[model samples]
Target: MVGQLQIEVLGELNVRRDGQLLPLPQSKKTRALLGYLAVVGRPQRREHLCKLFWEVPDDPRASLRWSLYKIRQITNTHDVDRLTADHHSVLLIPQAIDLDFTNVASLRPGDLDTLDVEVLESLAAAFRGEFLEGLRLPRCPTFEAWRLYHRDLVLRSRIEILRRLVSRLWEYPERARFYAHAIESLRGDAASIDLRSEAPDASVSGSSRDVARGNASATANRAGQPGSELADASAEPKAGPTVGTPQARSQAIRFCRASDRVRVAYALCGRGPAIVRAAHWMSHLQYDWESPVWRHWIDALSEEMMLIRYDERGNGLSDWDVADFSFAAMVTDLESVVDAAGLERFTLLGVSQSCAVSVAYAVRHPERLSGLILYGGFVQGWRKRSPHDVATHEAMTTLIREGWGNSNPVFRHLFTTMFIPGASQEQMGWFDELQRITVSPDNACRLHEAFGEMDVSDLLSQVAVPTLVLHARRDAAVPFGSGREFATGIPGARFVDLDSANHILLGNEPAFETFIREVGRFVAETVQR
Candidate 1:
C-alpha cells in the first residue's frame, strides 16, 4: 500500500500520511465530520451526514459534498479505498487508516491483567488526553454528545490502563509512583466511567434527526451499567468483537444462534491461549461481571488466558424462552458458543451441570480442545445415581417450583446454602437474588430436572483430552464422591480437593487461592504441551 493515512483522535485531531502532518479543512464542522466517520467504523448515510453537519439554512448536500471532497484530499490513496461514497452513503475504510484511538478502543476492563508488561506500558503512554481535544461543536448537539460520550470512554480506559500499570510496576516503584502521583488529580474527574451514558445508534434506515440522536432514548434502554453483550445486543458473528464495557472495556458479551435456533450469549476476554467455560448454574453476563461471586472467578481466569463464558439457553442472558432442556441440548449449547466464538483450540472448563457437557464435547471434538477442567461436577445425575439422591432431587424440585420465583428469599436461600454454605451474608444475598432473577421458576425446576437426568458416566471414559477435576471436600450441593467419579472415570484426569464448603468458592477463603493457583498452573502446562 502507498500513501498510508494515519489519524489520531485520542487526544487531538491530527491526520498524517507516511509520517508527514497534513492540513485539514479549516471548517470545524468538516473536521468534526471527519472525526465522526473515523471513530464510528462503519458506513453512514449521505442524508444523515448532511444532517449531522449542515443545517437547513445552508445547502446541506452541497456542503456535505464539499466536505467529502476536502476529506478525500487527505485520506484516499494507494488504491486503498480509504474514502468511498456512492449515491446513497459515505464510509471511511477503517482498515486503511492507522487510527490511534483504536489502540485504546480495543482495551477492555479485564484486558490490562492479561496484557504483557511492555504492552501495558506502551498503552499507558498512548493516552495524551481526552479524545478529540478542543474539537467541541456546541452547535451540533448530536456530534457534541458523541464526542463527550467517547471522551468518557477513552478517559475511563486511560485510568484503568494506569491502574493496571501501577499494580504491575510495583517492583519499579519510582516509575509506578510517577504514573500514580502524576495522574492522581485526573481520576477524580473521569476515572469512574458512567457507561450508563448512551450513544447514538444509527438504524438501518432512519432520518438525519434519527442519525443525529443516534437514538439516545433507545441507547439509554439498551446500555446497562457497563457494556453488557446481554443488555445491548445478543449475537456477534466472530470473536474479539470490541465493545466499550468495563469488564475490561471490550470483553464483548455477544450472542449466536444455535442449530436449534436458540440465541446463546457469550463473552470472550483477556489475551492468551483460549479457555472456554461451558455455561452452567445461574450466570448473568452483565450482573456477574460486577458481582462478588463470579467477578473474581472471571478476573482470575482471564488473567492468564482468553476466557470465554456464556449464559445457558434457558438461563441468564441467553434466550430464556427456550423449550429444549435436554442433556443433548445442553451439550449443543456449549458447542454453539465455542463455534460462535471462533475458537480453534481451547481448554474446556466445566462446572456443575456443564461438566457432563464438556466431557461429551471432548469425546466428540478431541482435536479442537487442549485439555478439560471439571469442578464440583458429577458423573451421573441424581436420577442416574442412588435412590437417596433421586429422592432429594424430587424434594428440591417441589421447593423450586413453588418459591424459586417468589419475592421472599426463603426458597432461594435453600439452594444458595448448599452451593456456598461457608459464604458470608453478603455473598449469600447476592446468590439468592441471582437465583431468583436469572431464571424463571418453571425453568429453574426444568434445569434441575435436566441436570438430574444427565447420565454422562458412559461418556466420561470417552473423554480424550487431559483433564483436571476439583471438588470442595465439604461441598454440600454435589458430593465429594461426584468429583472423585470424574477423576476416576476420565483417563489421565488429575483431581484436587479444595478445603472449603462453598461450591462457588468465595474470595475470603484460602480455597479460592488454591483454585486459582491450580487452574493457572494447569493452564500453563496445557499451553506448553
Candidate 2:
C-alpha cells in the first residue's frame, strides 16, 4: 500500500493511490490536462498549456490555475507528491506514478525475444484500448492533435508487440493463434500476421515481409494496366492470411479521386461477379472488416461475389474535412469508386441512408447495374416524410454537437440501440466506439442533417434493375412500413420482411441467416439471365 501512484490512460483516464482507485476531477479539461502531463513526462510552459486547452479572452491562465488546484486537491489528500508546478511551468512526477503507456514505450525489440510468455501477455493486455479512447475537446484543436499522434504511436507499438508474440510462439500454434486474433481484432483485416513461418528469428524485428510480398504481387498484376500507376500509388498494405482461416483475407484499400477532387477510400474483396456497396454513414473500411456489427455482411456477401465497399466523402478513411456531405456528393463517391474498379456490370447493395444513393445510381445508369439489394432503407428521410419527427431530429442533432466525441458512450449508445436492439454487450460496446472514431462530431451532425433532407421517392420508380428489399419487421431506426413503401415504388422489386426488432440484424439472429440466404438466392437467380 506504500508503492507509487498508478495512472491508466490507455483506455480510460483513471488514477490509483497505493493500489486503491482514486476519484478524479469531474471536469473533462481537468482530467485531460492531467493526462497530457503524464504522457509528455516533462515540465510544460504555462502559456503553452493554456493555449492548448483554452481559447483567448477566456482567461486561459485562470482556467489553468483552477485545473492545477483541482489536481493538487485530489493527489494531496492521499499525501502523494504527484504533481509539481512553478510560476511558469508544471510537471507530473514520473517517478511517483506508474503509467501504462510509459511501460509500453519503454519496451525494446530485444525484450520481445527473451521475455516470458506470461509477461508478454500482460504487457499486451495493458493496452486496453486506443490511447485515451473517446476523449475529445471540440475547442482544443492542439490537444486533439497531440492525442491523435500519441494514439497512432501507441497503436503501432501494440501491433509490434502482438506481431512479436505471434513470431516468438510460432512453435506453439494455439498460442500464436491467440496473439494473431488479438492483432486481427485491433487492426481488423488490415493486420498482416503470418503463422506459417518456421523461423521465429526472421520476424524478431516485427517487420511485415508477408505484406510486402502481397503488395509486390498486386503491383505485378497491375503492371500493364492503363491506370495501374494510379492504383498502385493509392493502394494500402494488403492484408495477409489470418491465423486459423487462410481464405479470410482483406482487400487492399485504394483511393479514387472524385470528380470534385476529393479522394475516396475503397476496398475490393473476394473473387467473382462484382457487388458494389454504396457508401454509407458510420463505416470504416479497415475497422468494419472485424466489427461484430458489420463483419457478417462482409463475410457472407464476399463468399459468393466480389464485394466492394468504400467510405463516403467526409467519413471513415476517406476525406473527412470535406465541404460536401450532400446526397449528390455521396452518389458521386459511389460513381468514382465503381469507375476506378473498372467493373462493367455489378449488383448494388445499400443500407440505411445510402439506399437512396443506390436508387439514384441504378436509375441513372441501369445498364451498368445487374441488380440492387436494399436493407433497412427508406426512400424518404425522417424530415422529408415525418413532419412530427422534426423536433426529435433537431434534439438529436443538438445532442450530437454537444456529446458526440466525448469519452462517455451514452450519446452513441442512443443510435446503437435503435440500430441493433438485439445486440449483445460486446456488439454494443464495439458499435459505441465505432461511432466516435468514424468521423468528427461536426461531420456527424452535418451528415445527420443532410440525411434528414434526403427525398428519393422519385428515383425509386425510375430504378429499372432487378431489386430485392429486406427490412426488419419492427425496425426502430427505419420503420418497416417505409421499407415496404420503398419496395413497392420500384418495378418488380421483391420485398421480404425479416422477423426482428433491430434495424441491423446481429450475426447470431435467425433473421440474419434468412437475410443472407435470400440475398444469395436473389443474386444467383438474377445474374444467370
Candidate 3:
C-alpha cells in the first residue's frame, strides 16, 4: 500500500495513493482524459488525444497541454514516470495499479466462458457501477462516446458472468437462482434503459433461423434505422461501432450489436463517400489491418473513400459462439453494421458469399444505397448451383472439418490454393494462418454447410441498385460461369472479367489493380457528393 496507487474506473473516477484518496482535477475534461489514458494504458498519439478530448477554434493543443498538467496532480511522483507525454504521444504507465476491468475489456469475444470461475467472480466484483460514473461531457462528444461504450462493455461483462455463474453453480441451488435472477434483472434494465438496444431481442431470438420468419419484417424496418445522436458528424461511435472523425486518419476498431445482440466488430477508415464491405468468411478487422493478402485491398479502398468493414457474426473478431450462422442472420449483421457506421446513403461492396446478401439487402432496402458492387459472388451457393453439386459440396465440408485446425498445412494449402492459386509463398502463408486463428474448425464447417445451401437467385432480379460484377476467368473456388450468371441474371448489371484463375486476386497481379480502378471510378460516379 505504501508504494501503490489504486485507481478504480469500473464505477466512478476514484484514485487512492498510499492508502489516502487523492482529489481529482477540477476540469471535467482533465478527469475524463485521465480515465481514458489509464483505461487504454497505451501510448496514444498527441494528435489523437487532441481530437478525442478537445475541439478546434479553441486552441485544442493548448487545452490538451493544460489537461496533461492537471492529470499530473495524481500521477506525478519522485518515482518512475507514471504519466509520460512527449512531442508525439502520451502514455500512462501505472507503477502499481489494478487492471481487472481493462483485463476483462481486452478479452476476445465469447472467451468469458473459457476463464476459471474464481477469475470471473473476481472480475465481476470490480463493477461497482457504471464506468467513469458522473463523468459525461456533452461538448466533448468523442470522449462521451468512448465513456458510454466502455460502460456498455461493463454491462455485457457483468451479465455474462452472472449467466455463467447461474449455469455452473448447479450444486448451489440458491446461489444459482440468485445469479439467474441477476441476469434477468440486468436484461430487464438493458431493455428499459437501453444499455444496448439489441440485448432484449437477442435473449429470446435464440438462432437466426428460428426468428427469421417472425423477424423478417422487423429486420427490414431496422435495416435503415439511423445511428444515435452524437454532437459531431453524421453518425456517433459506440462500443459496437466507431466512425472516424474527418481528420482522424487512424482506424478505431469498435463494436456494433447485431439484432441478435451478438457483438459485431467494425472499423472506419479515411473520409468521404462511405463504402460498407459486408463481412465474409475469413475477415478479421484487426488482423487484416496489416495483413499481406488483405492490406493492399484495405489501403486502396480507404484512400478512395471511407471504407466500413466488420467481421461477420461467427468468425473473425466477432463473437464466435453465436446462436445463428444462417444466411438470413448475415443480412441482419450487414444492416446492423451499416446503421452503426452512420452513413445516410453509401455504396455497398459484397465479396464471395456476401454478394448474395448484398442482393437481398438491395432488394429490401434500395432507398439506403447509392450503388451495389458484387465481386466473385454467385447467384446460387455451391450446393444450390445444381442438383449434382450437392455431393461435392458435402465432401468438401467433411474434408475441411477433419483437417481444418491441424498443424499440417496440407489442408489449408489445398483450400488456399483454390482461392488464390496465384498467391506467392508469403500470401499463401498468410491465408493459412488466417484460417487457424480467425475461426474454429467446427464453426468453419457449420458456415460451410450453411453457405452451400444459400439460394439468392430469386433476389438477383429484384436488385434495384446500380450494380457492378467482377470475377476471375478460371477461379478454381468458384466457376467462371457463376460470375456470368450474376451479370446476366441481374436486371441491369455490368460485368468485368479478369484474366486470372485465382478466386482472390493477389496484390502483385494486374487484376487487383484493375479491380481497384474500376471500384474507385464506379463509387465516385455513384456516391452522392
lDDT of each structure? 0.74, 0.75, 0.72
- For model 1, residues 378-408, the per-residue Cα lDDT tens digits are 8888998888988988999999999887545
Ranking by TM-score: 2, 3, 1
* lDDT, candidate 3, at 105: 72
Looking at candidate 2, the ten consecutive residues that score lowest on lDDT are 193-202
For residues 187-235, could you state the per-residue lDDT of candidate 3 as single tens digits?
A: 4333212223222222222232112121222232333343221111233
Candidate 3: pairs in clash:
239-255, 240-255, 240-256, 241-255
Q: What TM-score does each of the candidates earn? A: 0.56, 0.61, 0.60
When sorted by lDDT, best at the front, the candidate numbers are 2, 1, 3
User: Which candidate number has the best lDDT?
Assistant: 2
Residue 101 Cα positional deviation in candidate 1, in Å, after optimal superposition: 36
Instruction: Give the lDDT of residue 350 in candidate 1.
Output: 93
